[model samples]
Target: MTLQTLANAALILILVGWIGIRQLTWRPILVGRMWRLPIVFAAIGLFALSGSHGASSVTAVDAALLSLELVVSLGVGAAMGALATIRPLSSGDGAPDAPRFESRTGWVGLALWFVFIGVRVGIDVWAGALGSHLAASTGVIFVMVAANRVARTAVIGLRVSRLATVAPVPAGAR
Candidate 1:
């Protein structure tokens, strides 16, 4: 397929994946929600790799670049996920359940999700359009998605853990 054809195909698949993510997360949290993004992105990466022809063949440079990008992207995802997961200890209604800060977190996660997608598509296009030998081959997609998911999951897990901690008394109470 032509380069543009491949890019367009990749965009279409990404849009489909994005839509799936939105639909999957629109409802209340479920046991399955946590794993959906990582799995979907990983599956997409695998699909991209399979179609890349000769993806199994890689040079040292490509390996190194992928590794570096993975680490950097993972760090980026973690930082952003931290911002996305911020929540207040309680709600405005004086009820333990009603929450304002918590609601925006889902939107934050969704925004970060699209940010990761943008990075993936931008890098893919750059690598393809330039044909730079230094650029990561198709395998970068898998690593990028893996990095994003791992960091995001870790951050979210940390957020949940923090939620379990006992709330500190306000200064006036002390």
Candidate 2:
């Protein structure tokens, strides 16, 4: 199969990961573990990167684009992640680290997720149609998944940290 096809297939998989993520309800997503969606995204991101890099020799412009993608993706992802509805819940043990949480952005969150996905798909389609190597570049797909995960996880972590600080002590523990 052609490299472009391989890369596009990989790009399509990223959308699958996002769909799975959207199905989830925000409940202590990162509290005890990395969770399935992000893990899937990471694995998928890495796999796509391998396809992008192995497909051909990367150029300086490709590297620059990758860096730019990273910056934009991360910035956008961070904003989206921060926008996620994260709030602490009372865990059974009442442990500081064991934060119970929930997330919901309603229509806005879904719209944002779709917007990012649409843009990524559009880029992949446009580049692949022209046989531009950018379509096969690892950076584009990698940033799409990695940066979003970073932002969401960071937001969850930050919110959890804030909650831990002000949380009232559990009855017996206090």
Candidate 3:
């Protein structure tokens, strides 16, 4: 493996560890904040792709595999978001007027994460076997991850908005 490949692998491992831990915790569902990571990741991925593999060099196989990876990522992410447990924080918890929901993915969510990783790795291996290296580029990984996060964020945002409408803030707590 090249140094770049090793670095990319290390980065992926660190991201998986950090992101997985965060998802398993109970954290406030803030849609605005949730959008940041995915957006940034997508931009970085796009930049990397454009720089590393220009349009002229893209093969049909690479395109097809990338599409499949993206679809899988989005699907798995939506599943993870759907499985998340969202609950309203009590007034005693804090900010009674500014009602908020806390979310946790728990073990099942973690398992889905593994499924996502497994499918991603599998796709990469398949791409390598097919000699479509561009399909398994590090840039593609970021793009796929961004797609996954975007799907999860959308689902969670919808859930949070629905919950907010149903959950009223305490009177005079504003």
Candidate 4:
């Protein structure tokens, strides 16, 4: 398979593995403090690898565009993440339940992911397939968005499950 195909396959495998692990493991994996460092490192490593691949594949013009896209995407994602994090913090209804946060953040993340993906695709189509660097950059953006959305959804579900486990039910409610 080509590099693009290989990249796509690897992304799919990572997604599936994450889901499978979450489903099969009875105990909470990320709940432990030790897992935090490793998870962060793994994320960094993945980003590095993907960034290297994207840099190596694109031309200089495309690279610049891609870099700008990366910055904008990351800024938007960070803003959203912060917004999601802050919403729960601001609510005076005691500590926010993890499941509720997970569900709310998950939907928001998914919506943002879809919007970004759609925008990238729309831009590419509008630019036409006339062998332009913008088209190629948009393609890369699309792939990155797909990978991110999958990872985000998996994490969201895991958080939701953990929150559910610890959540208290109403006294009279069954």
Compare the candidates by TM-score and give the number of the best one: 3
> Against the hidden reference, what TM-scores do the models get?
0.58, 0.67, 0.89, 0.38
- Residue 109 of model 3, lDDT score: 85
Which residue pairs in candidate 4 have backbone atoms (N, alpha carbon, C) closer than 3 angstroms, thus clashing?
A: none
Writing each residue's lDDT as its tens digit, candidate 1 over 1-174 gives: 676447555864775476436533423222236567777777777777666654666665556555666776787668655765344434254444333234123555566666656665565555555553334344445557666766866776666556646563242322
**RMSD in angstroms, candidate 2?**
4.3
* Order of the predicted models by lDDT, top scorer first: 3, 2, 1, 4
Give each model's whole-structure lDDT: 0.55, 0.60, 0.82, 0.43
lDDT by residue for model 2 over 1-174, one digit each (tens)?
667567667766766565546635555545446445566666776676666543466655556545655666666566666777765454456555554565655456666666666666666555555555754455557546667667766776777667657774454542
Task: Judge candidate 3 at residue 148 and give its lDDT.
Answer: 93
Task: Compute the lDDT of residue 132 as modeled in candidate 2.
Answer: 56
Model 4 misplaced stretches (Cα beyond 4 Å): 1-58, 85-103, 126-130, 133-143, 146-174
Give the CA lDDT, 0 to 100, for residue 158 in model 2. Answer: 77
Screening candidate 2 with a backbone cut-off below 3 angstroms (N, C-alpha, C), the clashing residue pairs are none
Answer with 2 or 3, whichever has the higher lDDT: 3
Better of 3 and 4 by lDDT: 3
What is the C-alpha lDDT profile of model 3 across 1-174, one tens digit per residue? 767568667877888898889878998777888899999999998888887744448888888988898889999999988999988655444544343777999989888888888888888789878988687778888888899999999999998888778865554443
Q: Kindly give the number of clashing pairs for every candidate.
A: 0, 0, 0, 0
